[model samples]
Target chain A: MTSHPDVEALAFFAEELLEPDEERTVAHHIETCALCAATLDELTAVSGVLADVPPVPPMPQDVADLLDRRIDEAVRERAGSDDTATETGGPVAPVVPFTRPKKRGFNGMNLPRLMMLAAAGAVVVGGGGAVLNAVMSTQQESAVGGSAAPLLQEEQAEEAVPDAAQPYKPEIVGSGTDYTSKDLADQAADVLDATVPESGYGAEEEAQDGSILIEECAVSLGERLGVRFTLVDDARFEGAPAWVLFAPMGDTTEVYVVDPAGCESPDGVLEQETFTTR
Target chain B: MDAVQELPDRELLTRHTQGDDQAFAVLVRRHRDRLWAVAVRMMGDREEASDALQDAFLSAFRSADRFRGESQVTTWLHRIVVNACHDRLRRRKARPSTPTEDDTLDVLSNDRLGRVGGGPDHASQTEARLDVHAALETLPLDQRMALTLVDMLGYRVEEAAQILDVATGTVKSRCARGRAKLLPSLAHLRNPHPPRDVTTGRGGANPS
Candidate 1:
């Protein structure tokens, strides 16, 4: 089969078509076809330059301020009309409420209306008596079946008690020499286990022991293909405050923490950080 | 509610429908800058753009009930601005075309990329920028609007189509054609050498 020039196919690829298989096919074609390859390269270069264009400057302050006042006046006028309608106990000028009851002298009662009234009357009488009868029967049944019911209930209560609690005993496990900070770090790590990089947390640095101190630490997701979760506050966990930041790399997320020493260093504190995709 | 506090666009629309003046103000405050940008880019004249922006917003407020929220608030407002710009363009075309000296100078000086005799000023770069502006102005109104929305303003093709009331396919075709035509105008900035010919399966060859 003969294939056409496929300008659209080339354009799609040049635009980052965002599909892996299509991208791979386009890559193959560019490698084999010199003309397509050159065109693709030129288009990509121009697009990169275009992406650097700055945003349009904001509107003038005076114009914006004037519009702001006008809008306020319009909204207030509307609110005032609504208030007047409420006070007068009548419909607003153009917007008449649809709830005004219709005049009744027109025709004989319709079948649908008669049927609805009859159904309501029947429900009032039949429903009230049946409910009373059901309540009486249930009470009588419970009274006559008392002993058997109590035994069943007792068995159910026994079964509800967890087997694990039967021989419960308090056990103290030692996380030898690990302090509150270490415990918090471990907790933070566990919370972000799927996101943090394996090489990110230094293994040699042990967490210090003290009362959990709420320190402002930045928490971020590691490099992965997922949502970027930026934690705004240095959250206090069990007492230690840790900064959390999140970034998506490819298929996984990575989380990182700024060490306390680095946090105190007078670089005026780096408020923003960058993440690399793996 | 405190009338001065900022309300979201949807809330403002609701209040406007109920005849709330302050709510309308909040809506205008929220959208004025973005709407002004759209109008200015479309009309290429700041004064005309400002008028279009105000007129569009006023019309939108006047017909608040007609806005059914089928699309985004910004998208709906954009439709109004686009229509207003079209109306302005039609009116301008009907009148005599007079190129004032200041208009010519403004067109010339805009080539500096807003940097007047400050940093690295290259003649070719300046000429290329002016050529691009002129070429963009040369395109049909629809194609130009599509290009500005998709390429310059960073709107998604689907969103642009919605705002322009055209099919997505139409938007894609217009954008592709518009960008291709405008490419030659920036030839000074692009590579000077042309690409080699490549064979097509249809028993023909074309240059890249």
Candidate 2:
């Protein structure tokens, strides 16, 4: 029987065979051919001996210490620059936007402005809740069973639209007491109770509004995660102003910034914090 | 700072982008040891390695905002260190060093292969270690790096290729060639054969 010189082929494929997917092919070929199998054995043995070699001694301790010091200094310099930017309320150096193709519709909208609006929404929702409650409480007593009931129902109907679409919700908070205080609280509850379907965020205008809602959602999420969100820096990304969202996690903190370029992936966002474990 | 310390790499980087020095320090401390090893091995001298390591780390820190986390932190740092080491080597080579034949031979002797044996054989183990060191020094820089990363340091070939910025095939070929060269040198330690003419061609003559 004339057997093929499979050993040379195996030698050629030894490295490829190291990958798990190629093992079956390698094993089948080796089983039918003794020469290739022996070659594999030799390669394996050689690799084993080489593995026994010790690593070069670690870089000297003093050198490592110096590297640590230099890194610390660089980090400190960056922190100092950030602090200065925060103090002056000046634009901070932009984090490099993700080097990916820009997403559609991201160009027309201003993300930082939207983020600020979202922040304002949060403050309005949280701080205005009690005032809204007082207004609704008084209305509940006065309008127990008359034409005021229809007005309250109509107001609730207006708020039933998703938060992104309900421009009237913020207007209610802004134009405080324009409606009877009781009606405003009922309207706020109506806004909170309405569900914002993911599908509603499709049109460019809607998407921009959706982005604001998403930012609000992120803020709420951060709160739930025990992270405090602080706006520490602002810079332009891909021509749009990007806001730095700083969240303190225990003794360590995290920074998340939207990409002005509107990169689609999570990687599109920049995380530029020098964190240490407390 | 303590709050920053408890955050994960992703969170830490976010803080770093916002200009948190403590967050950057955490990243440096996390990566320094392995980066140092890569630098030291590539440069083959402690002083040069230190310089290379510091440059790489500092540059990485300055550019932390640019990091997209497409690859693991270690892989990214390794690429930086390797690039720095290559630059240093190029500069070192631009200024030549002349050594006496006796010194050259002494260095070669130090490169001898060490035996792999155990028991109360401290003397033998020490001799074997010396041999391994000598063998490592004899390899070309590329092969030496491949061997160091793949065999000794336990990096997968793909990871090593990323760090070395080479195709996987190139890493594999270098690793194979490196082992082949080291094998003969190691075998010769046991048999004491006269040195054969070493050729530079690939697969041309693997002295058995």
lDDT digits (tens) for residues B1-208 of candidate 2: 2666677877777787775657767876776777776776566556657766765775566555666788777777787777667654543443335232234345434432332343326555454444454466666777878887887678898999988768888888788777656654443333233135321321222211
Model 2 score (lDDT): 0.47
If you score just chain A, what TM-score does every candidate get?
0.27, 0.26
| Best candidate according to DockQ | 2
lDDT comparing candidate 1 with the true structure: 0.45
Q: CAPRI verdict on model 2?
A: incorrect
> For candidate 1, lDDT tens digit of each residue in A138-236?
323423453223233323322331111100111101111112334533433333332211111111112222101111222111111111232212333
The TM-score measured for candidate 1 stands at 0.46
> What's the TM for model 2?
0.45
What's the true lDDT of residue B88 in model 1?
55
DockQ of predicted candidate 2: 0.14
True interface contacts retained by model 2: 0.31
